[model samples]
Target: MAWEIGAVRWKVALALAAVLVAGCHGAAAPHAPASASEWHGNGAMGAADWSKQLDVTITIRDYGYLPRELRLRAGQPYRLTLVNYGSVPHYFVAPEFLASVATRKVEVREQAEIKAPVFTSFELRPRGGSLDVYLVPLRPGTYRAYCHVKDHLAMGVEGRIVVE
Candidate 1:
């Protein structure tokens, strides 16, 4: 009788532990702020309704961006989420590409939002960090996006953006 009681208690404890572990795994990860007020210069040209902008995530690894070619509409607003998964810092540089767009804001996780004279390139730190860039392309063209870090571009860390 005592053995049977002990077995039941053990089963209950195991079940409770499983439940706690599952709950922790199901928790959501932190995300960028969704409100216009949370972004810098809320009055910026492309700082329109966040709910209406198309969101895209680009992953940067050791040698390249996941999707080397990106397609965008000329006048549509877009929210670009850049995630760096490599062990070294990388830059998203595309001078001509940025010149063809009306930028809204650039947001780094847990940092201040950047607005105004938009930058032609942005740096991302190594490993598991992200930045959000908002903009609207104003013309149709194919532009090159490359990393300006030492020898990164030569190693094939480059991409293309086609605006139509």
Candidate 2:
């Protein structure tokens, strides 16, 4: 009877050891991608094909964005043009939305063509300043877009970006 109890305890110990080993191995392997290529591999564009992409413009006003709510499609490439008509400099801040999309480049009219994996914000120059963002939307969700310069959000300078 004592040997039977010992045998049961040994079995339980082995099972617990097996579970611990499995958990340890799982922790060593990452659940998320380690690099940008791995993260954007599903929807990244390999070549520049602007002809097929749709153009979407978001004009910046004094205390709001035109159209109020911007809509986009997942897996579609877009030329997102940000134009500031306001007298003061305004920032287009959409951290989560920008992170979800795979950015190809950002063009600032003879300033520079920035190639990056993601963009969190852009400060549009005051009065007729513009920039173009070339990107492919990979995730489908609603993200908040706002202007972060001096009580702008409080003054209703906020909108939503809905990707479907």
Candidate 3:
């Protein structure tokens, strides 16, 4: 009789614990402020490739970049038109482009390491301006682009491109 009571008690406790854990997992968390790399994807994350030569128009405002999301087909070649609407100079960096400002005059892609800048760069400033960059969408993965300016990216100034 004593053993039976102990087992029943343990079962009930386990069932309650399971229910609580399930509820916690299912509950949605509160919304948080946008992050620099806070790209939720373009309206076509899973949609078919609409066109090439992306002809993207990106606007920089308030130390931030607008239309912060991009979707693309992997390995496809395209061109991006970058516009700087901010009051300061910023760079669109492809992390694969490594540099040592302390010595090197220019940043080069790390080819031996299997990394390259899909979109190298386009120096931008305030008001309506444009820059063209050639990109070869390599690999099917989501890539992040952000301002390499001091504390600019930290201020939620970033963009994302999806290579699907």
CA-lDDT, candidates in order: 0.78, 0.83, 0.54
Query: Per-residue lDDT tens digits of candidate 1, residues 1-164?
Result: 99999999999999999999988667522322234443232444544565778988878888998789999987678998888899999888887887667677788868879874446777888898789888877769999988988899888888999999
Off by over 4 Å in 1: 1-50
lDDT per residue as tens, model 2, 119-146: 7899988999999998888789999989
Estimate, for each residue in 92-160, the C-alpha lDDT of model 3 and write its tens digit: 775542110001012222312212212245566666555544444445666677887789888978877
lDDT of 1 at 45: 54
Answer with 1 or 2, whichever has the higher lDDT: 2
Best by lDDT: 2
TM-score of each: 0.68, 0.74, 0.50
- List candidate 3 segments past 4 Å from native: 1-52, 97-119
Stretches > 4 Å off in candidate 2: 1-33, 47-49
Best-to-worst ranking by lDDT: 2, 1, 3
- For each candidate, C-alpha RMSD in Å? 14.5, 9.9, 14.2
lDDT of 3: 0.54
Judge candidate 1 against the unseen true structure and give its global Cα lDDT, from 0 to 1: 0.78
Against the true structure, whose TM-score is highest? Answer: 2
